[model samples]
Target: MSELLKTLLVDQLNVEVYQNRKVLGQVAAKSVALKMKEILKDKDRVRMIFAAAPSQNEFLEALTKEEGIDWSKVTAFHMDEYIGLQASAPQRFSHYLKERLFDIVNPGEVYLIDCENTIGDECRRYANLLTQEPIDIVCFGIGENGHIAFNDPPVADFQDPAIIKSVELDLVCQQQQVNDGCFTDIESVPTHALTLTIPTLISASYLFCMVPGTTKRDAVQKTLCGPISTKCPATILRRHENCTLYTDIDSCGAVEER
Candidate 1:
């Protein structure tokens, strides 16, 4: 078990800081696996939303290796996808999740966000799929600018009426993609993406947020210490009754210093 470096309650957000990214991922994965088992015990299936980014690499890798949970009873959905990226674009969130997770665990239903059709049609279709049943869990990470999914500060809506929608990418968000090596440069990154809104994401019964690395230190600090507003979009996690924020030494550095 990874040693817990610190624990804090930022409003309702349960924050846990670990020694390092690897240990943060392992401990978060183990806890999420246990939640999967508990939910599957009384339910026919488990539905989960996932975020795809290099920040999620450790958690997804660790989760897939966990034993005992019946993956066949789990349905998966990714939180966001680039709207104009080529089908072959390596930066596509769907492809990222496929390579790191879906292909590894082979969930019973893997619903990826596709842009082959009109973005509107795709958004409606995905929203329908998501609302057909309740979401058991949401496993995700924050951006360098504190966006959750693709709900950047400029576009995030806490009470958004749409379950999903296309949003223009914030410049900081685009640069973070470059920083994470998902894009060669900011100019090469997609300008828009399809993302589930804050309401849809927080509707899940359980939320396990894994944020690691030095790049996210500022965002993590804002999420935990800043006002609860879309200005730091991810600060809304504080209002989610069952959400847990998992961080590593590097990501939580700002909090430690303060």
Candidate 2:
């Protein structure tokens, strides 16, 4: 029942793969906890990056509950946020991270892109902060549109000059947020967003991407099989030396034939 199309490379990045979504999420969470423990051995401080999305709800929940992770030595960062939204806004990435991971764990430093600040200045400041630290691991999600962060299809560049910058949300990207129930409707979602570009996202020592659900099959295919281009932002993972993609049977359907 498989083999209709050529296998995509990104689909094969997993150091380990699982047949069950729940088990996949659990193994990924444990793998990250273990990886961080190993990386922190040689470094005094470790930085971690996280992304916010419905696809990550289970993964983040599992990761936050992971036993034995040294949260005290870790500094945290997130991938993106809506440009005009307040940090206190229900839709803000900062709030999502704080509730889902940071507040639950006492990290050494937790940096969030201040969406209320001037976009350009805030972008540069965040970029400088990111440059000062060597990221140990990055946990992220692929948008149903294949965006890595807010790096929507058109503006997601592999060589973005700034670590964080504003991007106009493509319809598919915006719709995915709503489809995932992050927003009540498309009209309620902010059209502009501040996002960590591809270069910075791919800069981490290890990257763990959590993707699940049949809604993501097309995107999973594009990201894994399509050419490594900005057209499908997440495709850049194909070049990373250490990247793990966690997905269930449904999301894995596109590449199952491989």
Candidate 3:
């Protein structure tokens, strides 16, 4: 077993775990489709958290192709957006999500972060919106720093009081965004962003984390093996009752699961 898996085992942790390198992208895509269908089966009004990143392209494509979802009944809330970015900007998470998923499904409602507005007020407004209804599922990705939902390494608080906040981007996290093609280079990437706090995500009924590529291997290992600390923000998922991590072969590396 890999050190990451060993650590998880030694800690006597509890979480529904599934790791795959074989047919990684396909498995993740299929799993997401099934989960969406499962959630929509009984609930007429469903709310979800949408994540935008290159790693999620395949998964989102698979979701868009899946039939039978009552798109009109679903509502979506964006997980994060770049601070100072206009909704029209190509780098905006809102634009990315709309082109990839929302435009295809035409959900009942789509709440995007207004990054251009006063950052603090926007966070509070978004928080109030999240409180209006329970989220059925949240789609997310792991940052190269093992962060989740833009909640960078040093700022991620499992018990954060604010539902959303403006955060300064760490070097690793910013570079990862650039490397993923969200920007031409590190200098072009935004220095700050608005992100959903760890507590807000933990409140969700379910969370699906999709992380692929070898570049993320170390992060995956750290998040899976490291202590449940803000340093490894994504580790908080271990406390979630219905959280899932989906990764491709290169990303899984030495982690063992049969």
lDDT of 3 by residue, 58-133 (tens): 7788778777777898888988889876667898999999999999889999998998789878988899999997
State the local distance difference test value for candidate 3: 0.78
Q: Please estimate how well model 2 matches the true structure, expressed as its whole-model Cα lDDT.
A: 0.81
The whole-model lDDT of each prediction reads 0.92, 0.81, 0.78
Which regions in candidate 3 have their CA more than 4 angstroms from the true location? 1-23
Task: Give the Å error, residue 108, model 2.
Answer: 1.6
Better of 1 and 3 by TM-score: 1
Candidate 1, clashing residue pairs?
A: none
By summed lDDT, the worst window of 10 consecutive residues in model 3 runs over 1-10
Clashes of each: 0, 1, 1
True-structure Cα RMSD, model 2? 3.7
Model 2 residue runs over 4 Å out of place are: 1-12
Q: Could you give the candidate ranking by TM-score, starting with the highest?
A: 1, 2, 3
Top-lDDT candidate index = 1
Q: Evaluate model 2: give its TM-score.
A: 0.92
Question: Model 1, clash count?
Answer: 0
Q: Which lDDT value does model 3 have at 139? A: 80
* Better candidate number, 1 or 2, judged by TM-score: 1
Off by over 4 Å in 1: 254-258
